[model samples]
Target: MLTQLSLPKLQIPFLCHGQFMVRVLVVSQAVAVVLAFAPGVYGDVWARLGFISVFVHWISIITTLCLCAARHKINQLKPISIISVVLCIFLTLTLIVSAVAFSLFSTLFNSINHEMSDFLAKNLMVAFIVALVAVQFLIVHAEKSEQLNAQTHAELNALQARIQPHFLFNTLNTVAELTHIDADAAEKSLLALSALFRAALDVGKLVPLQTELELAKQYLSLEQWRLGRRMNVNWQIPDALPAIQIPALTIQPLLENAIRYGIENSAEVGKLNIFSIESRNALTIVITNPYYQSIKSSGGNGIALDNIRQRLMLQYGSSASLTFGNSEGLYRVKLVIPKS
Candidate 1:
């Protein structure tokens, strides 16, 4: 669904402020209309050319700029309906002003009686086509700008929401217990907790793949300390990790899910596996954990997974993906990122 945001005339967003693109649209449209008026039946050849050159560029550029300004409202209409109505309205306004100016200026400067009806007859259809092209360009550009803004806003909110309260409380409890027995270890745990929270708050930006993997490792280490031998992690990362870029804290939530579903609920020690495979075109990271069958399953939709997918779409378009599957008694997730 489209947003109900409204915009007023003459207020263009920064994305629509490409003056070079606007001028190019104006000049090309102006030349096309001028050529259509070459076989002049009006008074003076040079005067007709000069008047059209001025009028065509003026009308086309203003109409396009104004369309961009009003895009939020205009985009609500259906595609064909918008194109038809926009062309009709702009063409009508353009012809009315051009016809009146033609008569007034010809009479004043050329001292000849030229009819407004003749001017309208000469330029109406050609001006309509030019207006159509200009309006379409602005409409497409404005719509894309709006979409990108909406996605960015959602991604920011997701970043702020991803701070897990349960993780914080559990880690603090572990810190309190460790403080009494092993003061130095407790101090290290407190520092780790603080670092993780700081990283959580500053996500939604890009970082190298190794940095993201390190964050996941930090999180797992803390969880293992709290859970003792019940939580086990096996990392199969390469000595030379890929230098690819990904969103910061991208893998942390997945690790949290692993602990929640696989380790926390189990009576026996549960194992979590982290491994990756790389190819020339893409890299795939696989996470697997033992899922005991005795516990009754609770159904809940995954907000973290949805958030990651949306962020991936915004950053990599269709080049990245997240998928889930199960084999034997183990659950698995695979994340694929393009090398490009």
Candidate 2:
């Protein structure tokens, strides 16, 4: 849970939801057509349509600017009240622009004042009713998207809270086992353990790849006090590692699983190999080890893998992955993270 939920939450600002500019353009174009024909007692239908198009786009731009300016205060209002306020503003703009539109229409076509007045009044009312529906559609759609993201975050936080205690208990066991045989190493392990507690339990955000790698190294060092040379690690990394960010404890659990299932079960001194591949847009980490198929725990990778997958989903959605499988003569686990 810490691995996934610690990643950033999806955010949509109140007035800056997706495709807002495009929605404004499309609604303005649509309303222009309908308003042009609403005044049936008009000459040259094409001329009237052209005239309305100008103010339709004009009104849309002004209304959008006003809403964006007041977005901070408006977001605090109740949903029903928000709708009422939006319509009131739309109606107010319509009333304000009506006289200007009437004068222009009369001048352009030499229409009588009475006819132009009727046309402007009827069209502005039509614009209000149409614009109200369009505005509400955009607001409701954005609200639903934000709500879904919020629920996902809540679930991840709850999962992180529950799993952290289990992880702490397991770490304490490793320290307890080291006390009798090697007091000096146990003391060092306690020091390393303190860092792990801060990195894991009090996670503020994803750490750099180098930072995560060192933590993994510390974990393996602590384990070696008990396992000795049996826990062999071959780290194949570039001289200058890429600046990649990953969730805390992202690679540590995988190493623990390797020791328990691959290293511990092997009759010969077990070897583990870890390396990285940096591409233009992604970082891929591969961990390979020798294992006995017969000794594999049926539920070996369940919780840890689930946790990693969850974290990836939270951070990168479906783009990032944790894939593990045994093939040929080696068991391989590959993790892919997007650079973005």
Candidate 3:
């Protein structure tokens, strides 16, 4: 049996955004200027402009407040329902404001006279047309935004998926090597591997920094078990890790790269160092390992680094960064995560 797929529901723009309100105010003022100069028998154009501006500003402010108030409910409505609801609010407010303006205009500006019915009809018509266009534009913009978000989510998941298999295969190979050498150690490695996988597989867009660090520790323990004295890791983490969220599986892959490229390819004991520098707005993690020039690294391809970079961009936009290079005979990777 085939089932129909459900498309994403339409989302309303946040009407309370400062930029949006500013645009509304500017457009309303422009409209007022145009209306005031519409070839009328006006003695004073400035007076007409002032009157129209006041009227339009009143309508704009009231409409904005009404929409902002009903935004939560309006967002839950279907496309047609949302359009209908917004139009009703706009037309209703415009009519009321138009009536008030007409009464005041007749009393104050005796030179210009507009019948109540004509004024109300004209205001309602304009409100309906403007509201319709605005609603359609907002809906289209939201739909495109939703589609872009969906595409990004799919790409993020694909990148995340790519990382797991590489991690699993590498960890399993290490466990296999350990089993032949020592059974009890292999059992402990399996336990650690289980904990690592649970964190990796069940992770969402972000996890606590502490959790990611723990996962990295588990992975490094498995590697230490396999490599023994060949690999020595020095941790310089703070006693109190910052309460921040980081992308999952971030640190482990960097450590894996260090082990694969820096440690395993070397004959002498390799040194790996992990440390953190904390500031008010950002946390920086630095990983450094020996870079051997003569000995060619067997697995030097940068799949993990590239994957981590893409994931960081998706999560943090441009605020967070991952950078690495060889500095003074040592390869260094630095990851910076913003507190925001």
Candidate 4:
């Protein structure tokens, strides 16, 4: 069954994120600075700034802690419900912090005179306004993020779809040709094709490196059967392949391109080599095949290579790369995947 991609739900900004926390602190300080410089007549500007900073920081820290504690449950709520709950939290925290700070100031600094009711009301009003603005910003950010994700998934699905029909036609043609010579071999090819199709259709964005290697092997097996004496493959994989997640169908498409442009086009037997090198920070896979400059194979427009490159970019950003070029009479394709 084909599963359609769903847009990600709107989520409250996690206070646990360092960036969110830093922004909160910075904004709080900015508010304190603005309050200190406001038109109201104040005794000492620095003292007023300090007092406001302490009060706002207290409210901000407590609110952040409370939200962080309940973030998991809050995230599961509907968007409107999340906003209501978060606003309620902010208002409640503001009231409590204001009451406590007012009592402390009254007790410790008798010179300062402010009514508890007025202070509490002021804090609650400010908190409500700030919370409303922040919530609106978060909602907008989440919506934009969700839309970007949906667009990426759509593009990925389209790119993935492009590969499938090409793969199916080529495999089916090979099987059809094989059926004339050997019925049993054609049946085995069909079974392999079924596994390949299942993996192609069912796989998510990422799969284990070993799984991709297996898929590549299955693809090569089909090609080997079709090409007979002309197809040759060499594997230099590690005994203990690094435990890493790779984009699905990462290797098979490259191998298909290799066979189509290199082995199938060549008159003599072509050597295809697949090897991997693992480093502390990254894993690299290299595929090489005999390159004949004279043989102009049809459909060498590099659709498969481009699809894989886009998928790699979407999956790993700049941390992964796919590069291919003719080097030393062999067409070499190098794929680098970050281990992190």
Each prediction's RMSD to truth: 12.6, 9.5, 7.6, 7.5
Most accurate candidate by TM-score = 4
List model 2 lDDT by residue over 1-340, tens digit each: 1232322322213343336667777878887787667655467777767777887887777777788677657756655556667777777787677667776566776433476558667766686667668655656655664565466446446655655565557667778987887788778989987877777663435888889889988877766765777878899977687777777778887887777678877788889999998888688999987766743454645556766777665555555789988877567889998775
Q: What is the TM-score of candidate 4? A: 0.57
> What residue runs in model 2 are displaced by over 4 Å at the alpha carbon?
1-9, 12-183, 294-297
Output the lDDT of residue 329, model 1: 76
Compute each candidate's TM-score over C-alphas: 0.56, 0.54, 0.56, 0.57
Candidate 1 local accuracy as lDDT? 0.69
Cα lDDT, model 4, residue 85: 91
User: How would you encode candidate 1's per-residue C-alpha lDDT over 20-65 as one tens digit per residue?
Assistant: 5565566866584557465645566666566656666666666666
Residue range 99-165, candidate 4, lDDT tens digits: 8888777655432467889878877887888998987787777777566556655665776676668
- The candidate with the higher TM-score, 1 or 2, is 1
The TM-score of candidate 1 is 0.56
User: What value does the lDDT take at residue 128 in candidate 3?
Assistant: 84
